[model samples]
Target chain A: MKNEIKIFSPATVANVACGFDVLGFCLDTIGDEMVIRKTEENGIKITKIEGYDLPFEAEKNVAGVSALAMYNALQPDCGFEIEIYKKIKPGSGIGSSSASAAGSVFGMNELLGKPLNNTELTNFAMKGEALASKCEHADNLAPAIFGGFTLVKSACPLKVLELPTPPDLFATLIHPQIEVKTSESRAILPKEIPLENAITQWANVGSLVHGLHTSDYNLIKESLTDVVIEPYRKQLIPHFDDVKSAVLEAGALGCAISGSGPSIFALSKSEATAKAVQLSMQNAYSKSNIQFETYVSKINTQGIKTL
Target chain B: MKNEIKIFSPATVANVACGFDVLGFCLDTIGDEMVIRKTEENGIKITKIEGYDLPFEAEKNVAGVSALAMYNALQPDCGFEIEIYKKIKPGSGIGSSSASAAGSVFGMNELLGKPLNNTELTNFAMKGEALASKCEHADNLAPAIFGGFTLVKSACPLKVLELPTPPDLFATLIHPQIEVKTSESRAILPKEIPLENAITQWANVGSLVHGLHTSDYNLIKESLTDVVIEPYRKQLIPHFDDVKSAVLEAGALGCAISGSGPSIFALSKSEATAKAVQLSMQNAYSKSNIQFETYVSKINTQGIKTL
Candidate 1:
């Protein structure tokens, strides 16, 4: 076919604080690049893999799975070769797998003259993630593919909403030297919840959405408390409480686990607070001799792009 | 007292199904009217009471207590004579007490030449509720004072947000003869909730808020389910399950107990569904041989109006 299409997908913060499987937002720091080429062949195949050591098998790799799903659905006659350059670290709280998955669908859709809309791309990308993670979750993929803070309402009807992120939200994320296996983390969470706490969590979640829409900083702060996952998950992260306290004491609005564990994100109003949060994380980690890399960046309103 | 002001306070729905103590909305169906006049005396006095044979003592009766709080706060160098024209039933589960409290504040605020903002009025109204219920909550008063769907973020600092109501939404409310006291209803809820259920509720609540803001009908329908409160509270309402089933079967978008309810509310897309819901409630209530009154109407967006 000899058709070439290039696309970029941003790194994403999945399970944003309290929003376990429902909320995600794009990150500007790291991402993946995928280049799709159509050739005169029977089916799709993976031509190249760069940046990280991901699978070369087109059906097993995240990017490959996503691209293959799209190809199968669209039933493109031309054979396509996908080249994925995965920059984000796989198995990190930052959506590495989702980026690759999103990148594959994004590139393939572009290569096929944009047959699939964002929703369709998100579904195809989620199917790709399911292939890798053994579960279908699209919070990360949707935002990475579509941009902005996104909510995945359902997987069946595939309802996705791109929420407007607050303007002055400077996020400070610290990924400690611990690697939390996604499978292990997923196992620890309980399936059933007591009725009352569930009600409160939803109230805060509703408030959080409203805060984003209205730009109400105080509401955002109030809604950021994760009474569900963080309470149980924080035990895995060293100095989680100390780091959270330091960030809040240093003028950060709220702090919580990023996705599952190891990575913690704090929000601040100004550059000073952002810098302070970065320092606070370093300080908290220093006492425990736990080294961590921190990112002090603004909200990534723009998700993925053609680069 | 000859020179004072009269104000109208709208009916409010507290413990708004999925959002207990956090969400409330005002309605135009039932309300209370209060007249406050400055007299030569040194303290507030309730000269007249109508609708319900409530206590007339200024510090004890909800209307009288609300007026007393406002009078004490303002310290206006005059005693006030209050007349309450209460329309909301005493045990209607439709924010009956809140209407009395809010009416007093609205009336007193008007008499005081609108000295307080809506937030301040809500505070005084909540104080009145505290005197009546022994609990200081803002859910009902906030909406009654502010109008529309409201979220009370912090009761201490007093933050309230009026959320966008879903469009083309009609409601059918059926009030049976049974009475479920708020205090008793609250006691039944479990204090601690499971983490998983909390996450699900938050996800749904987040989606609900988005649905309201965006006016997405399907999202609203999906978000309206209460896994936390409705199941437990339904036991207190006679024929609750049948009423809910009938309403849903008759084409209600959703149905739930209205507040700590013997009163149930069902939402529908059109007036036809609203009427159908009313008939369904009647059919369900027929089993108990308890005659019920049903109101088929759209959301009373124009909350309180001067007659």
Candidate 2:
């Protein structure tokens, strides 16, 4: 039997505009890669790390914690060591932690003879995210694990559903060189929201899901509106309104702060439009004098996979 | 062109479980029938009414107001007269008022040579619902006018999207003989909802839409949970908890208060299970010594069709 495996777990955009805390999708580009090998050690070990500052202890690092979670669940006869080559940056709000967490568990599961189903693997991966953010959220982890569009139906029992994505859909991600702690961004939101706004938000969520299923670009445009969280979170981003307007004017279907903040994403009907939207958003942020990286990609259909 | 037309507008179950004010679907068994004919008079008229106490004035009754709105919108050289045979009971939380309103407008639109599309017809029908409830909401009217599953993407510009429904899915509606005014039930709800609960609610809404499109029964069962409106509205419906439990145990995919309240609806994988759920829900309420009527139906695929 093969005793080692290498896997790639993609970056994810959570919230997806109107679907705050519930929706996410995987990006074709940008991710974390991990190589796992069976070892004679007593427990999980993080033998190596690259390209980012993260804890090395098996219990503290996201990758080590995730591999430990899987290892403890399986109680495999053989121990394992994981080496993570991180590319997705931390605190980017593009599911950097999730990529690491999912990559570890996914790689471990493959090396362990695939004992866990995707859902169970996702549950184990979420522990790593919880360790990082102090909250167990699958919006990012689910997409990283399952790929395409994902919805976290419930957090308590951990039900995640993979939604259909249109073939023509493309995403543009602009990661500004700044940091917005997920915990702080979440804390800044009001504990209570007006019922009216919630209704509008849910309406948009329903429409967005419908649009993805039917490949209706107009429906996607109409449903991408967010009334509750965006109104509050926009204050943390520079020129949020102008950038959103610029993208929309440049033929982007919709644009919103990715996950929590510091990264903005726009969905477009064509790759060309997505590229155009990337330039428009970048230009809007130019006056702010902040460094940013832009990526245009088709949605990643295959999430975490062994190579 | 024919000067007269008769149409049947199906009763709708709005706010299906977790989708408050945004989702709805047509029921095949219950509806309102309306006959609209071009008139020489200067204004609209409600010439006949049956099976319900409704106003005769053109601007006051749901049927009259709906026909008037359509007539005024078209400004056809001829006015219109409507006759309504109301079968769906008022205050039953089954889109009773919406049926009359949608039926009148639907019949008038056909009589006027189909000048209005389904979306435009829903808009005119919403005016009638607004006249009755004092607020314009298309949750009920959109489904009654369009058919199958429907989502009101936005109310301001009146964007309505018809969603796909699973073919094997069936609905069981048990309407207990009690009065719960839509306005009063709405007024009882808190103006603001906890953000946590709203997030949960929207997640379920997203999953519910996903389930319907993919025909995944487990997803449907998981997504039908309600946290925002049902807790407060269930107080108005007797044995609400027991009845919901009974239906679920009887193989219902999910169950919740249909529309505003006093009517409980359950979804099942088959017509047989739907019938069983209907009986179970009715029996749960039997101990309370309350009268009730039950309906088991396949989702009406063709909404507001001519007889």
Candidate 3:
């Protein structure tokens, strides 16, 4: 087994429209690179950080915390040092913290001769995710670890289902430089929802899953709806409706907030449509004064990859 | 075009566990038979009704109502005469009315040279379903019309999706001789549900659709759970908990009220397991003071079939 491993852990879009807290998909273009090395010492160390002013303390860093969670469980004979080159912005709502949390465990698992499954790795990554977000949901980390589209079926045992991705699916995302905390986005939600809206949401979720499995693009377009959360959460992001209408009018399959806020993502059937969707989003959000960055990515079938 | 048609319209188990008012599957061994013929008259006529005391008048009968809905729209230059031989019991919660409602549209479409597609047929059938249940829903009629498992993506526009059917899947259903009115069963549901519970319900719905597409029996088992509707509706079912426990112990995939209740349905992976489940349900519900019937049927792939 190799004593040192480097991996590319991609960002993810969680709470995928109708799926709410249970579904997410990985992105191909934007990610963070991490280097994990096994050392003779028995303690985790955060050796370096670049591109962002993240904490240097082992326990304070998501990568170190996640690596320590895995290391303490296996009691591997040697310690591990982690270096995070954070490319994803922390509050972009594109699962930056999740990338860091999942990348460390994925690389460590490889360096330790692959002792853990994706489900087990997700559990450890979720531990670090909880430290960053005050919640232990696998929706973000599961896709980062399992690749493609993943459904976090149950959180108790951390059952993450890997769903098939259509070859033609492409995603266009716009991350407006603003902070929308996950906790605040969650706090704005009502404690209860009407059962009628719940039924509609679940119907959308069911059809969306069907669309993914059969590669039915029309079905996917029809099912990418949210009657529960998005109605309220859209208030937090600037020009949410304008962006959504622009992408939809531009012939994108669907558009919704990426994760909790500020970052918005849309899915299209082809790269050309994705580019068109990106241009539309730029036109829609350019009216706002907030600075933004945009990207187009294919649905990442391999979650975390070795460099 | 054929002047007359004889057909078998299968009964369906709708609201499959977590998929309340959205998902349903047709059963092979249980259904209703109908004979439809083109008449020289200008209006639909209910010529015969046997095996059940249903209204013979065209406007009052489900079959006549559904056929008239289509006939009125098409003005097909002729009238239709329908004869019903009802085998499934009314108020059994096994889609008896939906069978009658869908059968007429399906048979009329064939006699009219298949002018309407399944989605259009489902809309005409909903006109009849509304008369029987005081609601315009396609949860039951869609599966009875389309065959196999179906998802009612939208009700107003009447989008009924034909989902893939895993070949080995079978169903065990118990129909106790008790009346649980569809309206009353729906009345018992809370208008507002906890957002947390709603999230769980949608997660299960999404995962169950995934399970059906992938044919993953374990995923199906984990997902056949209802956190929103069953808890209240089960009260109208006799020995619901006992039957569910017995079926699960007998290695069934999952169990829930067939539609609105007194009929409880359990899904199993194979016919043998379905039979075993039927026996278990019989044993579980035998202690009750009500007369009941039990059946084991494979999933019917073809909806309304010509005889």
Taking all chains together, the TM-score of candidate 1 against the true structure is 0.92
Model 3: lDDT to the true structure: 0.91
lDDT of 2 by residue, A104-202 (tens): 888877877788888998898889999989988899999999999998888778888888889989999888898787777988999999999999998
Ten residues in a row with the worst lDDT in model 2 chain B?
B65-74
Q: Rank the candidates by lDDT, best first.
A: 3, 2, 1
lDDT of 3 by residue, B1-307 (tens): 7899999989999999898889999998899999999988888988888899999987888888888889999998888889999999888898999999999999889988898889999999999988899889899998998899999989988788888887889999999998898889988999999999998998999888888888889899999998889999999987899999999999999998899988999989998999999999999988889899999999998988899
Model 3, runs deviating above 4 Å: none
Candidate 3: tens digits of C-alpha lDDT, residues A64-138: 888888989999889888999999999898899999999999998898888899899999999899889987988
lDDT of 1 by residue, B1-307 (tens): 2277776777677655556667777776667887777788788788999887988888888877877787788898777788888877777777888888888777666666778988888888887889767887888788787877887766777878789977687878888977678788888877766555565566677787787898887777787777777767888887888888898899888888787887888778888878987898888888787867888766766555444
Higher-lDDT candidate of 1 and 2 = 2
Q: What TM-score does chain B alone reach in each candidate, compared with the true chain B? A: 0.93, 0.97, 0.98
- DockQ for model 1 equals 0.56
The stretch of ten residues in a row with the least summed lDDT in candidate 1 chain A is A193-202
**Candidate 2 stretches greater than 4 Å from native:** none
Scored by lDDT, model 1 comes in at: 0.79
- The most accurate candidate by TM-score is 3
Between prediction 2 and prediction 3, the one with superior lDDT is 3
Candidate 2: tens digits of C-alpha lDDT, residues B151-266:
88878899988888899989999999998887779888999999999998988888888888888888889889889999899999988999999999999999999999789899
Each prediction's TM-score versus the true structure: 0.92, 0.96, 0.98
